[model samples]
Target: MSAINKVLFIAPRFHTNQIGIVKALLNEGVEVEFHVLIKGPTEDYAVLTPIKIEEGKFSRFLSKFLKTQKVNKYYAFPSFFEYFNTIKNFNADLIIIRDPGRFFSIVSTIIAKLLGIKICFYTQETLEIEAKNTFRYFFQKFYKTIFHAEWITPIGGTDTRIKKFLPFVVESRFDYLNETSAIEGYSSEKAVAVIGKFTARKRLIWALKLAQEFDCKIKIIGENTTKEHATVYQELLEYVEEHNLGDNVEFMCNLSHSRTLKELSCSNFFLLTARNEPASISVLESLSVGIPVICPLECGTSSYLTPEKTGYTYRQDDYDDLKNKFRRLLVHVSEDKKIRVECLNSSAENFSEQAYINKFNYIFKRE
Candidate 1:
């Protein structure tokens, strides 16, 4: 074991949260670098150097074959040569592979081991619910073992959730580095917040229905990841215009984290329409800001929702169920003052930026 002075992060895409984490690491006096292996150029950040990965046809086919098509297509995938070359060039003390299930990660782990560099992988794959004998299930199990890293960081932040997907893993291997949020107090307004990327997976249409039916304001905040999603946003605007709901519907695109949290703090409740969300950082932020949430039971974060206490959970992708739940909640339930304080306390104790930094300072130490 030696001192960990430098670390390298390999990610598919570099978002705001990732940037924050890197800045925190830098503030701790660790030299941080990133290989953002996505297809396009990365936005310049002062804290870290982000290098874009160039993927060839063979790498793309292999990524698809490994059933990591979603991550590879949206973020970026590295070829074996790319991974080896990047690791060789950096000479970082530790390597953090953001997604363990990707084909390139398996190669990265092998290369890191050969170089005697400490490496760990962060995983968000929920494969326990997958049908047995399916290709995806097999691939997931296969990759889990092939990762062969020194540690595993499961994003679920629970033993049960991690076990459900990766049952064979040991407790010691679970490095629970959860995301963090800042709670800037709360204000109850007649508004519902819908936050996250403006992608098809978010199921924003369901949230829009609530705004259409209810009298309160609906705030949709997020950036479009693609042209198709931008068109979806446009169609949503058209729907609002046609229904003359412009006064109730407000679209705030690509807000900074602090600004988004400020908007979330004023809202009455946050809405989650994504049926199969692994876990939402926005939902955590909502809870941190003392705002309750209404999420589908299928969402990983739904486990945090306590009915009539913190928030509510409807059936997955059931608009009728969500509508009924919303109606009942709007009429019967308001964010209780005690519940708001409790929510803030729970989130701050568990998911604050300081807590995250403390965990990293301890765990990032080389063993």
Candidate 2:
């Protein structure tokens, strides 16, 4: 077998999917190193080790500006230096970067090309015509530059939309099927669970409102990131208090990934109300635990969620639709043990981690 000695992964944040990919590559005997442009402590991976590039206050301020501008040009100088230094030091064979949406990726791609390193771009969002602009022009140019040598891998339900713009080397869903075995039986509960960052776009207030109306408990697990997030959380808290839902709605902040998974295992159901999402790992993780997921049809994961079989998908931003769906799920809660088992079985077959790895290997070996 041809050897894949070293790989450098650049990403915005660490998630289970990213860790899973690194773990798989390590199992295949690849030396993996990660470079995070933004700094945050992450879950430790047994297969891969991560190295962070220390940033000065000036550079950090500039990065924030560039991120807001959607122009990655500011990161070029520092990223080029870091990439060149790392390539020379590590003698890496493959350089993998996630999401061409950032300026760091553009810089990394250029440096990799100059050093004769193989390049791979892992995309999460659909590169549709709607993204056309100065920023997208540069993104498309980079896409053309890396067209031949490496691979283009996208994870989620927007494959049809993405293929319309760029040639996809491979496609994989966000779920890891290997871990989810088809388990029988489920426990009933009076409350629902919502997980993810506490942001306005997530429409978490909607879930809170539903919980209040039905006199059911709503456990919200996530952190408030920005002022907008603080405001949203505050408003929700006030609403809960005003509507006398203090006992029914509980807020838990920033549980680690593994702990979150453990929490999902016991929840009656999962709720997601994102205004937009390419794919949500939370939904997949919930499904893996055999918890029925209730989300909007526009969410990427909705494509895989078969109503009455797997879970439910309601109309976007339609409170009536959401209320009705919640009611249906509540009514069927007593009868969902068999349904949950079927959902788990079906999800296990479709979203296995081994399947994802096989698809990745095929893309990596493409001529």
lDDT of each candidate versus the true structure: 0.64, 0.65
For each candidate in turn, the TM-score is: 0.75, 0.80
Determine which window of 10 residues in candidate 1 has minimal summed lDDT: 166-175
- Which pairs clash in the backbone of model 2? 72-103, 177-351, 177-352, 177-353, 178-353
Candidate 1 Cα deviation (angstroms), residue 325: 3.7
* Residues 288-351, model 2: lDDT tens digits: 6677788887775665677777788888879899899988887665565666666566555655
Residues 1-367, candidate 1, lDDT per residue (tens digit)? 3687888877776644465567666776778888765533224365566877677667666556555446545423566666687788889888887666555565667788888887766655433444333775566456545544444333444433122221111111001111212122233345788986667788887777788777677889877667976888888888888988888888998666667767776777788888688766566667766777888777765655567676778888678888888876565345345655566665655555555565665555433
Evaluate model 2: give its lDDT. Answer: 0.65
Error of 1 at 8 (Å): 2.1
